[model samples]
Target: MLIPYTVKPRPDTGLINSKLGIWLFLASEVMLFGALFSSYILLRVNSVDWPVGSTILSVPIAAFNTVVLISSSITVIMAWASLKMGNLSKGRMYILITFLLGLTFMCVKAYEYNTKFHHGLFPSESTFMAIYFTLTGLHGLHVLGGMIVFAYFWGPGAKMWKTEPEHFTNRIEIVGLYWHFVDLVWIFLFPVLYLL
Candidate 1:
């Protein structure tokens, strides 16, 4: 038997199963990140000495990653739009671009972490470093997760398009929503962890 609301909207919610599921999932994610952010704020406010973020973190590198993430967000939307417009090849290309941008962001973050380690700056060294690592590291994992999904949809998952184009397009839209959220989180992180 076919799954209900896999393609068609549920009359009561006007959303497919996946769409509603993603939004709900994102709400939980917001709470998770919100708690971490709140903890960071409390820690910083109560601490006797707090270093200015820009003085410790590399603004240029963080700025570059911000651009990369924002660009990936655009590319993800373009991928969904391409599929919606019946352009499979273009959709695949955009998905590939989005994946590469995410990969670039991760690599840059890894390099930054390496540089910090080389200088003996670790999470244990200070509360600031601890929260910085916690925030960015978690966000990095989310980016990696999105990249994995993008890779799948760009490769084997593309077969779905041939058999169920609308369903595949809807899947792309769902992924785009998640990708946009991930990017939005980074936009908040860039200033909070790197400039504040």
Candidate 2:
């Protein structure tokens, strides 16, 4: 005869609750980007040219992308909460939703970049284009990287999400923190690059 046993997590699993740890890491990331934006602001304020996007990018499109990124952040939270409640299936679906929104945001960003470059606003032409591309390009790569990570966890460990909820929630929490950081960076970038 054979019997099944329920395994308990090691006591040391509490070493650093993934949620809290990721939050701390994300906080540090926030400070890092804050410094970069402050530099961009100082550079912008001292420039002689006030007109940035004059005939280059579309304001409405950037605004739409902002809304999408913010909405994705909400979906990520919902996914984490769903996992917290032990609904692994719902959590997985929301994770996929968040991934889709992230992809959509990147697509929109690519389009905006294409439009700008097509109009002869190459980085070499001016410092504005240089800083603009540097900041936004780095931010876009982070978004794309997070999406890759999300896809990885979504496929492999999804089943563990149900039977081993602790680890599942931990993974989602880390990804959520990174996703939120990406969105937070954009929140500031949108104003600097598009609004003012």
lDDT of each: 0.94, 0.80
lDDT string for model 1 (53-97, tens) is 999889999999999999999999999999989999999999999
Stretches of model 1 off by over 4 angstroms after superposition: none
Q: Output the TM-score of candidate 2.
A: 0.84
Worst-scoring 10-residue span by lDDT in model 1 = 1-10
Please give, for residues 84-143, the per-residue lDDT of candidate 2 as tens digits: 888878888999998899899999989888887788888887777888898888899989
Give residue 90's lDDT in candidate 1 (0 to 100): 100
lDDT of 2: 0.80
* Structural similarity to truth (TM-score) of each candidate: 0.98, 0.84
Per-model C-alpha RMSD? 0.9, 5.2
* Candidate number achieving the greatest lDDT relative to the actual structure: 1
Residue 78 CA displacement from its true place in model 2, Å: 1.3
